[model samples]
Target chain A: MSLSRSSAIPRSALTTMAASRRTVLRGMALSGLAVGGANLLAACGGDDDSGPSSGSGATVKFGINEADGSGPAYDRLKGMADAYTKETDTKVSLNAVDHNTFQESINTYLQGTPDDVFTWFAGFRMAQFAENGLITDLSDVWPIDGLNDSFKQASTAPDGKQYFVPVSYYPWAVFYRKSVFEKNGWVAPETNDDFMALMDDMQGKGITPFAFGDKDGWPAMGTFDILNMRLNGFDFHMSLMAGDEAWDGDEVKLVFDTWRTLLPYHQADPLGRTWQEAATAMGKGECGMYLLGTFVVDALGENGEDLDFFTFPQLDSSIPADSLDAPIDGFCVAAAGQNQEAGKEMIKWLGSAQAADAGNNAADAPFIAANSGASTSTYSDLQKKSVEVVSAAANIAQFMDRDTNADFANTVMIPSIQEFLKNPDDIDGITASIQEQANSIF
Target chain B: MTDIEQTRAEAPQQQRAAAPPQGREKKLPTRDRWVVITMVTIPLVLVVLLVWVPAALSFALSFGKWNGFGDLDTIEWVGFQNYKDIATIYPPFWPAIQHNLIWLVFLFLFPTVLGMLLAVVLDREMRGSRFYQTAFYMPVVLSMALIGFIWQLFYSRDQGLINDVFGTQIDWYGDPDINLWAVLVATAWRHTGYIMLIYLAGLKGVDASLREAAAVDGAGEVKTFFNVIFPVMRPINLIVIVIVVIESLRAFDIVWVINKGRNGLEVIGALVAQNVIGEATRYGFGSALAVIMMLISSVFITIYLRNVFREERTR
Candidate 1:
């Protein structure tokens, strides 16, 4: 084993540097030229607002996990890519991998030779990688791209610097069957009490008030995110998650109470079902509603079910929610990436309007780009209404799964939520375990 | 890696193909055979370079400390810290091992009984025996990921077909209490047919005359089979047991796919992967778990191998 290890030192794992040598050298040479090329492309086509320069032989390989295929979603992306290629002459080598293998493949790709730009989930998940210097610093490019000031301070800890450009922001909302709501004469509510009354009325009509699949476990976490935000505003939620406070506090207890109250109304056996399965219930009108992201539109379209969207019901009317759900997904460059300039350009483009449009038009709409000064939406009214809620939100917290340190997320947060559902009596135990787990990692 | 493999062939080739002083080359079949070995060994070297080398690195990963991805030198040397943790020290570690042992027992035993019975029954020239054999053998072809999904749907407490048919709800992989039984049931369904096929092969080789002679000597059918046919299928029995043992040891996908081992169904394989792939990023811990699993599996293999060798020694 020792013999093998010593001999294997100069093997393919180290070949990452060997592989990217040419690409990095080439990209650096191009970056110097791209500074010149950007003026020409921007001046030539005033309509094309893509920041990453494109001319003859200027191409950046943008790695994405979303599948780009013959779906309407992909068609929209192709249209945007087509526009992008024509307008700027910059070819974003759209390398889309399967979602299931995305993390593993990206890890392999980055270690071997990082892509110019890649899609990343925001919060500690990306923050850890950024800390390891696996991700790049886009600080030089962020201001040049005209990113929002609020985003600069907010995405700072996550990006290792105020480097990430917010392209498109997505919001999660509760989606319900239009037919079920119409049949029951139930309207969307403005407060927690009104929502509960509506849920009771729907249950009286023999409809499940909520449908959720905890197969991936994140669906429950998503529900918890919106519930906490609605019960206590988004700032308190984000701050509490930042470990500034404990989850056992009264405000957080109220959030847990909301889950306990709604548990009876939820389709109880969502135990082994995937998010798609749970959302399919809402699509088939088996359940009155499902709380999910803009990604639900594709599932609804696949189910051919009509649906309406609504935000989480807020208790305090005075303080604004900004939005009811957690907004997630972002792009981060690898700091140790071989093609550092390409990586920066990729981040710059991802933060630019064009990348946001491409991202929105992909196989599934993950919601409009989180970019400021634009709505950036192509979803249905139900989806658009939710996006609007986020745009108008006073503040939004990224999903807890992504936001929290993964130790706490996987070990404490997920198990606690699952345990709470199985046995709520263990709340004190759950609270203690969560605190311990958080401290161990933090 | 390539240099080590091709030394016997490549050294002579370069000398003969482009020697410093070109002399008359040998036209013998020995030289021709040597040339063939050289040409063929190049691809093999490349394959090892690309595929086998990485695999070896991953295998080494089961020993040393390195997260799934990072700088090479950053891999800390922890000795057998991970293995010691799992086998003797860690809290959750032993529980996972115990769960795997429990899985191995059920995984081998349940299928053996079911397969042996099915094999004897099907050994008779029944009208639809071939169909039964084919149906039982079908699940062996399926990937574990697909099977996990199918069983998950079966064990669904609400809309599951099982509840609809049996008029009772059971959360298979979700509820913390009943999940092991659910995982075992799914695993058994897949293995039962495979064991049956092995037994069927064993039954074909069993002498029918010996069974008849036993029956003629005043043995009943049940007594004839146990005293007669059962002992003869020992070799086949060993094969089935060995497979089930190794499979139970290496089992990962079904557990991972089914709620990521949340519902008390956590096994050794699941534990190993969680450290490597999930938030823990504890490579040494994962490797330690793997080495423990390997040691346990080796014991099982060694015992089975000893039995087979012992039978041979006696013969």
Candidate 2:
């Protein structure tokens, strides 16, 4: 009656089992390994070591989100690190981790022995860390030249203290090749009617109006963000993201309803395509336009030179088309770093226009530095355009995922949105489910 | 009778001569006793630490809520709330259960049987059997991540080889109805090879005389397989069933890669990962999932061990 290890041994003798018996145990053992493996990962949080480093020379470890081979993103971060090292005469150790891994491990990384200054995104993601005391307050780093009020606001947490240092930003918009637009004699749409007309015109010309993809689940959030911003306005969208606004509200419903109407104009089977693949379709002229971040150029590669973008058209006349999802990427100081003083110093310098310029100058595919004082001489047409749109914007969103609780955004929103994409008709059900889940989490 | 026997006769006296200070029974040499203690203690410690501790922790954590940050004091004991939510509110839970069961049944029905058949066919020393064996076994050696990536080349909707070759446009990985089947097909490709290798090894070990004896008794190949050889390879059959169950229950990597187990590709393991593995630290909810999965696995393990114990009793 007992299920014990001792019971397993005599059965081998009784059964005269084949060698595959061992292999069967190996399979079971593999799962046992998986259980232990997952738990080991769970147990990987770092012990608190908040004491300052006792070393003679000042040094700081920076946990970079860019791995070595990630082209320009890595190059820019490396450039920043080198600049910091040169300015302070202190060594800044760069511990590079892959982007996704860095994000996934952020909770553990922060609780554990995190590097002094780590790369991170702004908005609610940063605010969450600040709330938990995972990151150091950087309010003292304010009044950085070339950084505007909006950039400063993005860095500030709920407690009126800054946790993030603005570095660069990219806005999501409707990207199109200038060559295709010129050839087709198409103009950028400004209002809802004009947008629909453009979509109709593109469809008539035998081109898919939009190159859409949602396989990763987050790409479609950019669409949802713009639609919500246009229809409901920025304040409402921000509140919706903050979980203060109901997801099942009529305003949110309108966004979904409008999206449903526009679905036909988007590329079919979007759940199957990655954003890169969709971007390729746009690049190849199979699709007329793509609504994505400026980084869509990376996917376009050579055709990137011809890339031009316009902000998503306004749906409600009362709500200006001034707000867009311009997710700001930046750096933060780990509260538990051994060298907090050095970390804060480095983060302050990181906020400076000179640091932005150093990073921008060192990389070929330079980011649109948040500091306006950074050199714009190396700016591409797209970069120049992005800066113009962002500056002109009355409100900015850190995209849907960044503007909400990580747990809620990932576990609830990703699937709910994907579910909506699968069955656009179930807007009511989807929104209700979202609200129910949000109620629990928030 | 011999010099060694004479020495053994004097061993107790010799041991007593060396150390008689303490009242003690005769035992093996201290070195050998230490060695035995070390051997027993090490594995016991490992089994307790690696297996039982985590399993127990997972079960305990299922009753609590925590975001997997800060200290243990942060964990709020919410007793059964996570499980309640998972069963009632979580959309992915039931679908994940269904998919896991489907994966088990599908693996058993197709790849396990097909692999055995392939093993039997290749068992007859046919021309290029070695080549066929290598071809079938190639996918088993590849990591599941690589296999998922390779299949994406064929499963891509607009540009995949399947569409280009067949002149059809089915979203293999996107359409909910088709994506599970698509992923299952990829998993079976690898599973088939694994089962084939194991069955082939088992078939190789089958006594040649048993088959010859059946043949002499006027048994055809099919009849011989069923009547005699199959019955004799019962142990191998049990092992195969065990392997299949284990493989299906732990089917996470392929589907996770496909879409993080969403939109009909949901499996219990993937759901756990989706909640706990990434930035989302819904720890209690994920632990409830892990506990439920463990409970399911325990049923199969119990059945397996019971069958083995019953067989042993008969013997």
Candidate 3:
């Protein structure tokens, strides 16, 4: 029976069957390719021929940091583009790239064939490009309605000319679930002593007082920023980030010393945990609070109905705790682009409340629009609180990575902060190492 | 038949016709000579263009400070300042060197020895040996990035299998004091499969009569392998050693996927990528690190080539 079974499938017959199967697969693959090609051609044709012209015949190329088919973020950007095309005669063409790829290759991209307007962060990252003449001066786009003085300050480059158009921002604050806070009879602290007492109360109840993670090496910078602002005030913190102040000075040491004292209240072994895992712990009621941006809601996969936040309370009576990190996201026009006037005109409209509403209505998750005139009816409770807290602040600092030189911030501060996290007692050693590297880079 | 016979008949005449002028050496036709020259020149040009030019440029760039923003004329010549800063100020540099040496030593001690033992045992034709071979070699088929993610399931502190199973909260990929050793353990899982497959192939090529002769002379199994089989596989042993050395020097993708080589997982390759490939744009500093890595690799490569040439001479 075995011999007959082996002889039943002759080698030539098996080869014929395999060949037929490959032929069928090839036929299917060709049809799939034909359909894909037709779709691509149709997309290209629609972009060139279908849009109505009301403002001008010019087409402004926009380089977005989000990938083409990515969810809400891409949808919001596309919605704004479509809205602008309808309001104006000029056409907007989008060139979408992955977020990390766009950032890493930004230097080459700006120097090479950059699009007319591109998504970017406000602060030193924008100023660097402006200084190098890679981006156009958009001073004419300024005095935009609904954008206040703080937004204008964030948009201006080092040369006292507007180089960026403010779009949206999110504030970093101490976030806690309202249910957890109410269950524990803890109100948001108003002073340094009250904050300490709140942490003690949480610890006594056998819950970690804070959810902390620094595995990606950037989250810990948020802690340092708040501590520095609360202890040394806002201007000193900005000077320190700009490499004007010595890193091993007394002001910096005090920030580290205060943070070290509070380390015990944080969740242990944070280097192994990601921010999402830390947020999960807070959501599960294992931790009492977390200090992160409002995007922490996205990590917890909820609409943030249960979430509420307060600015970190006063650590020193002399230094008002009114300064906070509220990083602004915006757009810049490339100097090398072919249609500079159209790019400036589009960005001018992009900074308006109408553009903000178009984006918010399209996306499932909405950004906190930078324009104060933007509609607040669609904001979640958490986002509404964020908008209120941010506007009330006396000084708004961009986060550490965005405010400083990219080289020093990435290579020096990231490792220095991680080292401090690993060994909190070595303030002198860590600060000295940072100063030495900072001297070399700056 | 006619073509073969005609070629045979003409071979002596052609050789005789060319030999007189060239002093017993037959010359090639112009077309064949051009083919020979073209084959040799193409690879020579490619190697010079792709490999040597970049290496030379890296060495030159190491001496200058450039943020990769402008033309070549914008590069400021800084002499050896980059190398000085790397030695004195860069904190990750020394740790990365120590980790690389540890990687080399650990690979030699654990995976290389373990793989040879498994290869010898599997050569005995025991029951289910095929199944054992497949199980041992499966990791070699996977990429290092995939291996890192697969092991992350076991190494993650809160969500991993190891902590869950053991009820211990060890930070396998986090704590600086222990994470390097933890990463090395994961590395050995993939590396053992690779070394085992190479040794298995080497063991198969050993002459059966040499083993029989050893047994006939009253040698035991271990004794026969050590005395007769091991020395006979000298070329394969050298190849395996070179491979392990090369692999350790270029060890990057796994640790990079884990944490971008921060915390406890820094290596030379990762440090280079951190400076050059990211938004840092410290091209001059990255080139210095690359040059240092190249110098370290050339030392091992030099020793390997010298030994190989010495063996060839003796043969």
Candidate 4:
């Protein structure tokens, strides 16, 4: 492994400058073969690493999950690349792909010849790759100023080394329209009794307390994550995701049973409605509140200016409401990347507030940068609030999909959750099935 | 010259040449032999590599656990563990099987019969018959992905056209009980056009004199169709049945487009894709699902082939 790592440094640099030029020529010859089926792997490998401009300066390929053309995310990434190039003289080649497609193809993208630095999330997914040697060890790049210890903890793998660099993040919370809440004389709850009373009050007024949807099968995970964290605490939630705690245990049952009591307060037949449609309901004041990530603004669109959120109330007094699902989006250096030095340098720079400032300045949709030193002048009220909520949280859990094995989460948990939605009464059967599958997978 | 003209000219010559293989072999030029070899070998190689190799690989992978990364050495052989887990613990497996069977039966019963009836009606060459035929065939030209999108406009619960029209909310795509039937209706809309087109072509080929003779014998249109035209159109009927069976078994794209085959739309194909495609590379588990699907397809293939061969022998 050491030998392989040592050899990769020069190999990547050489490949960037030399092999890239030859690949353009080879790509033309092999286009016919590549267009067909079997040689696609070879074709993609040739296209991703290097571009036509084989400049004398160091080059790092940055695999961006956002698509090309005009978008805030694309502009932000482009700005980051330009800044990185201007400052360090390292050409950052951006390979932009559609977000979902990028996610679905991540396994192949990593195992194959991946870009030097690629966008990723900080959680169990990152740790899994780190354990499998698909990502480079980035412990040396840590101690970046303005990034708190919580971000570092999220970035660290089980091996006691960091594999990720936190850039931007968004928190999951109970969001509502300010005007609607003000008109109804409602206040954000702080305790279990307060929350229940608030729900009852909303119900008495003929308003659905919660705008819920699970048609896509992932939105409900936010609800489960928050509920589990509040009831059993973050340690138990993490263990549950890690396949350590019994899914069929009393703790999990309590979470579901508690959820069942609150189900009546949520919008009916959520399996039919998408998260966007549900968010729109809250935007229209048809529902009292929505529990989701800060990106729920995308669904609210222009009306998002009216949006305000509060963290989910404390369920158990023993466990404070300091934990929340605030999934951090970041970057990782691929183990298979040729230019580890350039990649590490790029990652190190990315962790700094300067990079965040550069990224935010480039786009209309400014991200709530992870670095405390990042500029806040351009931030929207919501982005500023998101930063505050995330920073104050003691323990942050990445969303369910990011916090567990991909196969278990996608294949087992998605269907399992959908089933639970259809038949909320069958908690025993649902938990048993989840446990059985989880046991097999783990 | 056009393709048909060229084929017409070459047809007799090719047939005459093929009659005596021994004589042709001796006289066959080296260039022609090379061309023939290349033509046969390319398809043969393609079929083996594209179809047989993947099928065999899936079978082999079913016995091992792999995440579709690293070298072959990374595959840990777990014997029948994946299969055991699927049969015993997997929630979607049983539903996928049931859905597939339901799809087959629904297609055969509704679309096949509806298509035949429409073909019969359109065979009369009434005024504006061409317009009706074109209108009926329109959905067939649209891709299944597009069809799924079109139906989503009508089926959405909160703001769907169906709810607006009826003033009643029905979860068309979300309710496990009704979503299957709702999707089947959309699928049938497309299938009906395809079957109708095939049957129309078959109807046109049925000798008109037979119908005239039935009419002379005091037979009505219905009697003539059942007694004379139907038996004569056995070949076409058989083809329609085969097409329906194949379409039903391979029903995937529409359901997949809707929800990746979740929430009461769990087909075998979608389940396989859910596991194997994209980043969810549970190679062993996915392969087991695929192998089971292949076995189910083989049963249908065997029955179809046997019926075809038996018919040929009788003829």
Docking class of 2: incorrect
How much DockQ does model 4 earn? 0.36
Which of candidates 2 and 4 is the stronger one according to DockQ? 4
- For residues B89-143, what per-residue lDDT tens digits would candidate 4 score against the true structure? 9999999899999999999999989999999999999999999999999999997
For candidate 2, write residues A295-322 as lDDT tens digits.
8988877736788999998789898899
| lDDT assessment of candidate 4 | 0.84
Candidate 1 CAPRI grade: incorrect
Ranking by DockQ: 4, 2, 3, 1
- What total of clashing residue pairs does each candidate reach? 14, 1, 2, 1
Local error of candidate 3 at residue B283 (angstroms): 0.8
**For candidate 4, what is the DockQ-based docking class?**
acceptable
Give the TM-scores of the predictions, in the order they appear.
Answer: 0.77, 0.89, 0.89, 0.90
Find the candidate with the highest DockQ and give its number. Answer: 4
- How much does each candidate deviate at the interface, measured as C-alpha RMSD after superposition? 8.8, 11.2, 19.3, 11.0
Give a tens-digit lDDT track for model 1, residues A1-442: 1222332232232221112232233333323333443454346444454454445346666666667663543444445455556666766677666454456334444554445677666665566666666676666776734456656654576534754556555567778777778877788887778888988887887878888788676678888887777678777877777787776667777777767777898877565667877877787777888888767767655532466777777766765555454455566776534345655654665566666666455535445655653444565565556555765666667788677655456645765687777776666666665665455335
Give lDDT tens digits, candidate 4, residues A26-116: 3232222223323434455454655432333868889999998758888888889889898878788898887976786576567656688
How do the candidates score on chain B by TM-score?
0.76, 0.89, 0.90, 0.89
lDDT of 1 by residue, B190-225 (tens): 888888888899999876766766767888889878
Individual DockQ of the candidates? 0.16, 0.22, 0.19, 0.36
